[model samples]
Target: MAIVSTSTSAFYERARAGMKDLRSQAETLQAQLGSGQKLTRSSDDPVAAARLRTLSRLESLSTIDKTNANRANADLTLADSAMSNMSNSIIRAQELATQAASTTLTHSQRAGIAEELAQIHDDLYALANSRDSSGHALFGGNNTGNAYTLDAGGNAQYIGSNTSAELPIGDGQSVTRSMTGRQLFNFTDANGNDTDVMATIKTLAAALTSGTADPAAAANDALGSLKTGLDTLSTAQTVVGTRLAWLDVVSERRTSLSELRSTEEADLGGTDIASTVAQLQQTLTVLEASQASFTKLSGLSLFDNLR
Candidate 1:
């Protein structure tokens, strides 16, 4: 009788422990199904967890790269718009100079044209010092201040850096994000003279208004300088357009890399739904059977008949 009682107690303890284990297994499977992830903790799968960490780091870097690319693209877009306006202003200056060069125009008429040229110069100066979305000078070249400033003599001066700013868009890859005033507005003319567009316009305006020399000759010289200004603008536009195209290419590559990282992460961390569900079902069934058997065994006592 003693041996039988000891055996029964051992059976009950073993059955209870088994049910507890089954319950724990069921919970694990349920959590995985709900979360749709196989490895919640590092202990769940060490190798897979390590791989996920790496993929996450790469994904973070990709996000940063994308942001930088977008910012660079936006700054370049602003620069392009400003350059377009500058081109239009230069063309208008050409027309005004042509009119002034006519022997038919009077002194007052020539002075009036110079007055309009001065306004265009002011507008170009403002445009050159235009700000980006972040309020930094668009052509400042790493400077947060204005790209061009007016001197005491009213000449437009380049206050920005010599080299334009660059942004990193990928691993070991960078793109020019800004232009310098020196590159866009300060260019050499056909005569190899270092002339700023605004300075040239100012000089021409003063010459036209001076009334001391032949207005036609002054107008002709200004027209040549304006042509040089147009060429310089065209070159800058080409450079900006090329950079924009390069940004597109880099963006495409970033998207592709992002997709690859996502795939790798899914393969490493995602759950096997079908297999997990089957395991949960099996655990539930075994737990229920064990509970029913334990209940029946607990009620069957040798002392019950004696009572």
Candidate 2:
């Protein structure tokens, strides 16, 4: 009722070995595909997978921070340029006012100077409406698309909305990216005096061109007002410089923080390829040997007949 065969025993043993090899090969292939790295995956080591995910998250956070920093830098740059142009306009007006103050200039001469001053006022309006690289007005306050428009009476008046958009640069830091004409150039001075440069230019132009012989006394009065307008422009320029300095400090800190985040990400998620490759090779060798042994043992089993 019983039969003894070395071939049968070897056949059973070989079948078991082949099954184990098949399972191992499947695992190795799965690991290779999953890791794509041939070694670093959850199946290979769960701890490494968790750490890699953490690193990835850190990297993403760093990218967001970098974006915030870039916006801050861009906004500050735009403000700086706007202030510089306004400063130049102020200086030009100062020169004209000084010339007008001189007694040697006759009525005709003062009228000519007033004509030029009108052009400068228009130019200043254009500068105040200047836009940034993003198509938003640099001086329009809060990233408005349009700048100040002249009223029916040729006064500089703003058409943009009232909201001031604040940009965030992380850690509760914020900055307003724009300023309106009303806030800067057309504001009331410490003495509650109106110093709208456009208004001053219009008034001066009308008076000088009226053919009044000895407009010298009136021109002298305008010099003080011109100085007031100059002060307003200067103050705006100073604010721009201060904002730029703050942005510079923040930008420097952001760069350093980004570097630290990069290092943390590397430590958390980076792979070690050398050890992974060695294990893959060993699994392949074992699989090949089992396949070869199974092929030879198939002939010796009773379940098989060679024709």
Candidate 3:
């Protein structure tokens, strides 16, 4: 019969390796409990870690979308308020025009109305050149300067871009930040001639105060253009309101998506506290048992047994 022999040193080495492995497992569980995460390193769970990275990137993009949505909301709100003021100014101008069209009014009275109309025109010009929250022209599209500039003849000229800049909100969606001055203030008059609200008011004021042959006729003629301009303003207001409502819907969707991502992130990377605690207890118990067994086995040798 052939006898297989194991050395004492080899036996102790084997026992140490086993106990060391158990200790390492216990430490890992303890670390997981302390960190409140299942993974201390990507190597611990490569697939889960990769998914976490993707979720984190998505979360960052969502944050950017939220910021853009907020900015768009602010810019649109400013536009709506400015339009409201312009509408009021236009209504007041209409009333003045109605009074001026009456033959009962004296030349001085008509001149006073023209002065008021000039002031309203100035106000409208300023409103058209209003600045946004970022200090850029609110109705200037992508232009950094004033939306409407005064020409050599004192006429308001739109120098802004034809289209507004678009801001990305999220999920492949975008929104136009604002409308250009030309979009809001300029329109085709009843005579099928192209003119803007400010220019119509300017021409009417000039005729009334500049000793024209028929001031009342000019005032009556401006009534039709003023009505058309008011209608254009109303339509523009409605468009802005619609955009604001759309933003609200997109905001709700973004919130829902954000919540979903949070839930997914928790499910993917969050530790299972109770199960982890139980596992840690079991591993510690096994490690302690192994250590005790190794100590006992190491102390046992031929000399100790003989003694």
Separately for all candidates shown, the number of backbone clashes (residues 3 or more apart, or on different chains) is: 0, 2, 0
TM-score of each model, in listed order: 0.91, 0.73, 0.90
Q: In candidate 2, how many clashes are counted? A: 2
User: Which regions of candidate 1 fall more than 4 Å away from where they truly are?
Assistant: 297-307
Q: lDDT of all predictions, in order shown?
A: 0.89, 0.69, 0.90
Error of 1 at 131 (Å): 0.5
* Per-residue alpha-carbon lDDT of candidate 2 for residues 48-91, written as tens digits (9 for 90 to 100): 66766775686676567667667656765776677677767767
Clashing pairs in 3: none
When summed lDDT is taken over every stretch of 10 residues in candidate 2, the lowest stretch is 264-273
The lDDT of model 3 is 0.90
True-structure lDDT of candidate 2: 0.69
